[model samples]
Target chain A: MQIKHAASAGTLESSDITITLKPADNGVTIALDSSVEKQFGRQIKAQIEAALKALDITAVAVEATDKGALDCTIKARTIAAAYRAADVQDYDWEEINSWIN
Target chain B: MAELRRIWLTIDHDEAAAWAALLTKSGLAVDHQVEVTFGMFEGETLLATASLYGQIIKCVAVDPAAQSENLLAPLLQAAFDQLDDNGSQHAFIYTKPSTQAFFQSLGFKPLAHSDEVVLLERGYPDLDDYLHTLQQAKRPGSAAAIVMNANPFTRGHHYLVSQAAQQYDTVYVFVLSAERALFSAADRLAMVKLGTQEFSNVVVLPTRDYMVSSATFPSYFLKDRADLAVAKQQARIDAELFVQKIAPTLGITARFVSEEPLSPVTAVYNTELAAAFVGHIQLHVLPRKAVAGAPISATTVRQALQNADQSTLEKLLLPSIYRYIKEHSSHAN
Candidate 1:
């Protein structure tokens, strides 16, 4: 299955990425457009992996268009988009703890 | 000289009316505004009058025609004595600028000059603005947080901020901005600024009414409420908003708080908020720095003022605040 997702920050030209998923695979494959790949090539791949792990869905192909995103924000957005694609309304994303253990 | 007579009077409507009547007879016209007291004295004779306006006692006067020695002084002293005996926290008197010197000699300072009246306050100023600004600033290194009420920039408050500063690169102190507070917002801000002058990185900002007022929840939640769950949820929502929306705007991702039991509700809310924002923000609760019994609190300072225990208050407050209070109070008393 092929999924297309677009994320934008108004008037700055929206970035779009496409991901392809295969059956029975427990890892993700990410494809990036040339422009985004040039800017955030390695970081985007890492973010895709983290987002997939966060959603507990390992078998997937992912693509992304990069605006400016920190690793954490990218992870958050990816998990949100993937959840939207799967029609999953609930995910137990771990809460952030402020205290030092 | 008028004879000095000690009369014990309850602060009630009838007593206020009787006091007003006596002041009127003694050539002192009292409009009888709430929270005002008036009196008249001649030679050693002391004529006392008081008007009760709601929970506050106003329009205390002494008979001018009555022969009394130091009539005004004794009359004012007597009224304060009565209120002190009754354990009143709020008291005020309106006198002309010329007579201000006399009141100052007695221990009252001009509260703040206004177009209509020169107000005199008996307590410390509130430092909410500075604390709010601090809370709004971004925390450095995502390591620690800071909070403060800033009731009057005391030495103890300075000590707390300094300690927090040492631990965290950025400390955000939340100044309470509830309208009903005793000190004016500006005065409180000024005092806190003055008190924390040495600490450069500390950011102080005002805590909006929703976060700090009794309408939402008490500062510490000292008493157990029936709807603890509801209160806790509301507090959590407010804290989340503060952390996610407000804190981020100021570049602060962490909150530093003093570990005191006075604000259990806030402590609980912070714990939950921290969990929700885990990995994004940090919450640090510092143990109290105490000299005598337990940690220092504004309540303890106020109690000392009420009891005339200047020593304890001096110990708890900064030198500037102590000097301001002493100089102003000495003039008024």
Candidate 2:
């Protein structure tokens, strides 16, 4: 699915990631910043990409400011931003929650 | 006054022990479970220290000579900036009663009180500002008030609002701002605005760290029966602030709440609300709206969505809330 417009989710608080996204025509482009970027940058990006892929979302610009959010938090925020961008109402709750499972 | 620069405390820092001793000497209990502990130092000497543990900022103390100087505010400002840098927009400071006014002068409003510590916040809108904004849109006379999360605005919530709009001259719907909620705060605000559009007299406001807010009642998130006693006391302090400050500021004469059969936490909160406002404001306890012989609540609406129970969700939520949640709920996997 194509991102329809600009949207955001999450916060700057500890253990949270604030995700901002805008529509794109080709593929997902991610720009990320985090204190532990040197060590976890690739890991965080992988987590985000996995979430967007699970949502079947493509063609988007993603900006994520991570404050040590765990893998599950990154996924949730990424998918949440996707929902806001697509302007869809129903979400895959179990899939989003299954991070723990 | 001596110049004080911030010093982040660490085990290697030379003054770490001094900071610990100061809190004890100052009659303030030391919370070892701090997220960040720092102090204001004058050159090599530590004059004051404050600790942050989640929303609670504590372990604050000043050297005897520095007490007469104006230093607490700057020390607090340092802590506040740290909290903000970490993405906390609103925060609580645990301080001694004698120094309460010092915090108040710096835009920190007191929310709850105990014999030992007082809780104050820096980001909640001032009561006067809230009133001023409401004045431009509505009149002040015999208003009914309610504070709700409406995580997903249920039909039961709508029923309560409809009754309040008809029974009173004005209705103030205060949505509990989320430090964390399933629905985004922006979406929740928009849903309520559109949901209650028919009632021109209905004024929606953010429950700005006022009563039963997450900041005022952090223990509430625990949802454990073991924490019940402490939660009750916290709610009492919060409700007192509501009846004593917030209700009077808005000229609200009656407060509305539904009896909770589903959550023990809310049932205790309602009981506290009733007790706090007995002589000040009338408390109306409305019965929970039920569907399939069960109460219609945000909790049930969330469960239905998680379970993919479309019929239960449709029955529990207003069309707007259902639509909002359908589009906005954060998935769990």
Candidate 3:
């Protein structure tokens, strides 16, 4: 899905990550800010990339501010932000389920 | 610990006094011009507060007595969310030097700072991106810059640009982009471009809220003289931003400014600007150009336009600028 507008999801609270997605002419670029950047930054970025791959999104800019979130939380926030940026209201549950399974 | 509830101070007036007291107690002056204020309340007390003024975030404070030390993160997040909803992709904040590290932890990078204040910004298309665009205009020789509002683009402005162009290899004219002046930014820019088109080394560009803008110097357009101290502080910060970020980007080694003898506020700003550029960049203070025994000024041209004195305008402005002003006199204000 092509990103249509700028949208954001999640919160700044502990154990949650805030993900902001905006349309970009360049390919996917992630600006990740986390306290654990020296250790877990790569893993956090990998999870976001996996989520975007599942959604078939190739060109978008992401700003993720991580507050010690789990992998599942990162995936959920990325998916929500991608959907909002794409302006797609209906969730493709079966396709999402296939990615999860 | 009682759960903190998010409240809007602009919509709810009852908590306004407490918010003011909190800001004052935190050693911050209360500015009433902020557009939106978000407060985190616990029962009857205010715990944390942050405000959004246009794209700028100001007057952020967290109660010292509050249980959680992490109130700043949430407060800033709410402000950013409001800024995003308002369709602003970038955010700027002016805060004390002591709090720089705290803000940097949350992805805010420092743009420029003095002993008293530090300017920080978050989001894309930041200062580096701005400097990259300026890099395209970079010439090989020693360069000088002139920043002007040029409200009506008078002959004095022409003299300043002409003088700088003759002295330096290249002259970059940064026109103030704020719309609070009598003439619109576009009109002012067009006038400057036309006035300086005679010089091959002169390039006119908008300041783009980076120099002499409401974000950098809030009191520049405000007529109130009571805030002279605030105006001086803002002048220092604005000069530092120029010296640290802008001048080096375009290899500007000298700056030209017209002597401001009539306005005390501008005199103070000139003092602060000179002090900030000490030992870093050369400052040239040129005498104001005169016409028919009187100094040429945009204010004088504006007064003449108001009274429909075409003779005074003919003497003070270029022929082309005078014609442009004559055509747009209806919307001059």
Candidate 4:
């Protein structure tokens, strides 16, 4: 879905992530910041990209600040942020869970 | 390890003394006037704290013992959430150079820095976007700049802009965008644009949050009334941002100003700007334009405004500016 507005979800606390989304002109750009960037930066980015792909969100700028969150947490934060940026108030939990699992 | 309870000083002022002590211990001066102050406490001990003043987050201090707790991340999260609630799409932090990396981890990109302080920001339409917009307006020539609040555009402002227009191949007038003055930023900018229409070489632009903003020069706003030392440091930060980033980007070689015989705050800023611009950019201080024996100033214009003295206002302002003020003030009344 096309991102309608800028939104963010999650926090900077431990084992969590903060995802900020801004509407962009073209393509997805994810700027990830994590202490584990050297080790799992690619994996973390891959998880975010996969979630955005699941949501079919194109033309969005993503800033993810990771505090060593697990893949599930990362995906959850990304989906939450994308939905908010898209201004989709109601959640289709069945469909979202299908993408996560 | 018990879960930390949060303290909101705006809600509860009882912990203010503890908050000040913690900040002092962490090497931050306590500025009591911030809009929001948040503290994280484990039992009775204040572990970390952060405060927001407009769009700027400042006076953040985490106790060394709580360093293991990783309190900064959560503290800043609280700050950002508060900012979001305030409907501020952007935020800045004026911090020490040493702590830059930690804030960077939270997604703040450093925009400019001097030896003493670094200005970092987090949000869209950031400094690069601002600079890119400015780059479009850049002209190749001996360019000079003048930055002014122009609370009400006066003959004094016209004199400074006209003088620069004559001396330089191109002149850029950056009107202060801070809304703390008697006139709104939009009004101030309009007045400057209207007042300088005769100067063909002049380009009028808003300073945005990059220059003399509450972020850069908080003292310009009355509520942020700072002491001489604080004002000097803020002036240095503002000047360095210009000399290091803005001047080079826009090819501004020199800046023009009239001598300040009024307003001690502005006088201090002028002194600091002179010192900071040395060896980097040229600083020209022209004599104040006077009427009879007295200098023409926006402060004088404001005084005339307060008394509804049209004659004094007409004598001090250009026809365009006078007309704009007359129309707007009537609308306001």
Q: Chain A TM-score of model 2 versus the true structure?
A: 0.89
Per-residue lDDT tens digits for candidate 4, residues B1-333, read 524455666566668778988889988888876887777887876878888889899889888777867778777877878888877768899899999999998889888787888889987657776787799899888999999999998999999998999999999999998888889999999999899998888988889998989888888675335677788888888888898889999999899988987677788889988998999889999999999889998888999989888889889999888889888885444
Off by over 4 Å in 3: A1-11, A20-30, A51-63, A76-101, B1-14, B329-333
**Top model by lDDT, which number?**
4
lDDT of 4 by residue, A53-93 (tens): 99888788888888999999999999888888888889989
Query: By summed lDDT, which 10 consecutive residues of candidate 2 chain B come out lowest?
Result: B122-131
Interface DockQ per candidate: 0.00, 0.02, 0.40, 0.65
Model 1: CAPRI class:
incorrect
What would you estimate as the lDDT of candidate 4? 0.86
Alpha-carbon lDDT, every model: 0.52, 0.74, 0.85, 0.86
Clash count per candidate: 75, 12, 0, 1
Superposed model 1: Cα runs more than 4 Å off: A1-101, B1-145, B154-156, B213-227, B262-267, B326-332
- Writing each residue's lDDT as its tens digit, candidate 2 over B53-95 gives 6766767788886785656656665676776688664567756
Q: Model 1, range B1-333, lDDT digits (tens) per residue? A: 344453324455554566656767855554533343444434333365544332223354554554333455545545555555565423444444444554443334343332223323221111123234444454546334455556655656777778777877766566666545445565566667767767877666666433444323343333344245534544554555455455555676666666657755656766656665577676666676676866777767767777879788878888777666666453344
Q: Chain B, TM-score, each prediction? A: 0.51, 0.76, 0.92, 0.95
CA deviation > 4 Å runs, candidate 4: A3-5, A23-25, A56-58, A87-98, B2-14, B330-333
Better of 2 and 4 by TM-score: 4
